[model samples]
Target: MALPEGKMDVNLSNTAVVLTDPQNDFLREDGVAWKLVEESVKENNTIENLEKLLKAAKAQKMKCFISPHYYYPYDHDWKFAAPLEEMMHSGGMYDRKGPLTMEEFRESGADFLNVLKPYIEDGETVIASPHKIYGPENNDLILQLRKHGIQRVILAGMSANLCLESHMREFLEQGFEVAVVTDATAAAKLPDMDAYAAAMINFRMIANAMWTTEEAIEKIASS
Candidate 1:
């Protein structure tokens, strides 16, 4: 059966740049996922590409939202976890090491990259309440976007197969039009699987559109 037709043109007035897990724990060299994702991130020039996308979005006055991953001390109390979730907790991937309202989490290795900080710290870019792990269910992202009257999302950010993909799935199901910036996200490479490769296949299959940063920037500018 043919899928129902949908519009691809993004209406800037109702569009927001929604990024997932743009933290140092995923982008920086010292991050836990670095060794596994270094090649893919470098190959795609993820950081520079994302910077360009962010700058363009700001210039175009497009609202931006960040769906961050944070694990507070209490999260360790969860009784059961999936393999990856268990690994994340064990490795302290995004652990905050402090209370939820404390600023200590911002000082940790899980903070957003320095280059992206200026854009994010500004009053315009809204940082949604941190997602407990990966998806929007545990976060206030959808609420934040809806409050801003957003209906479309220009999506990007870390761990293509994990957080980024999780964000994409939820956003799509929530009746939001989503465009995935393909090069703006990267993924870990495990011993038995190439996560980035896996993500690309799904990205193309599921997202309304899979865009390069340049393509997305151009579209946003034209809009």
Candidate 2:
């Protein structure tokens, strides 16, 4: 049996680049989860590819939204956690001292990648409330997109098997056309799991379109 093949109708006026977890904890070498994701990140050229997408968004004047992940002190007190949540809580991964405090927030694990900050902080990009889980269901991404009349998305960013993949699935359910920039996302590889491989399969099975950074940039430029 063959799955449906889909293509995106790139309309910048009604399309936005939705990036998930483009933060230090996922992209930087010193990040808490770096060791776990390093191989996949390097294998996919994830960081450089993500930067390419960001640069394209800027050059094309594309609307952009970031769905970040963050955990304040009170978050640690939750009565239960999923496996990844346990891993995140164990070492204060993506931890911000407090919801209202920026104390030591600069250059922290939760901060956006420094190289990508100019575009994200340009006073135009919409930064949604931090999602506590793997998807945007807990955040305001859909609302933000709707407010701007965005019905299609160019999706990219960190931890392919988890947050990014989760975001893709949610967008589909929410009626947004999602095109994943495959190489711009990566996942943690463990002794017992090849997460990135798993995610690639799902992306193929799901997303309306699967594009490389160059392809996405071209579409955006022409859109």
Candidate 3:
């Protein structure tokens, strides 16, 4: 669907793909976030669709920004950890246990780095926004986008109702054209999907358009 008040039909010619928290903690079958959006994660072929989208974006020579979730060693800071702590204990997405600390979890799962290594090696712009809160975190996302002269952003990643929504709102506030790829974004889980859908509906009503991965790919290809 078209963005409610914002412009439709963005010029992908200079658009950037801003992947939000596509980490093992979010995408892997054993991921905490996966448990939340397992159905959509599976049904939407989230990983596969993201790969396709990434490939298409690369083929078009679009800019790419990766926003990976990372938590420093300290007390609880993530917003969703309270109830999750009692319910899932250390099994939740933000919880750390065993030999792997939260920082380690982030480092190991930042495979997107490897995926985009070639581009970086080739002198392409690769922005990394780490330890970012929903959207208000003092990350380098905005600065990187401005440095690259990027105006349009294609968002994809986990927890559609949280991280994705936060980034979308921030981007919109910054006056950037934003597009959320539904197939690439997954909610926390079933009942949560309802919330996710509602948030997307609200997002569509204000910030930017929400399109399926296939539609996003087609638009990118056409552009």
Best lDDT among the predictions, by candidate number:
2
Assess candidate 2 and give its lDDT: 0.91
Give the least accurate 10-residue stretch of model 3, judged by summed lDDT: 95-104
lDDT of 1 by residue, 1-223 (tens): 7544334677788998988888887788888667878988998999998899999999988999988888888889999999888978888888786644657766566789889998998998998888876788888899998899998898999889888989889989999888899899888876898899999888777888888899899899999
Regions of candidate 1 where Cα sits further than 4 Å from its true position: 1-7, 99-103
Query: Model 3, range 1-223, lDDT digits (tens) per residue?
Result: 6533544465655588888776766677665556676776787788777788888887888787877655543534445654544343355444333324434443354344344345433556475656445663577878888888889998887668777888888888888888888888777656433656766776677657778889888888887
Superior candidate under TM-score, 1 versus 3: 1
Give the distance in Å from residue 197's predicted Cα in candidate 2 to where it truly belongs: 0.8
Runs of candidate 2 with Cα error greater than 4 angstroms are: none
The 0-to-1 C-alpha lDDT of every candidate, in the order given, reads 0.86, 0.91, 0.68
- What pairs collide in candidate 1? none
Query: Cα deviation in Å at residue 45, candidate 2?
Result: 1.3
TM-scores of all candidate predictions against the true structure: 0.93, 0.97, 0.78
Minimal lDDT window, size 10, model 2: 3-12
Whole-model alpha-carbon lDDT for candidate 1: 0.86
Tell me how many clashing residue pairs each candidate has: 0, 1, 3
Choose the strongest candidate by TM-score.
2
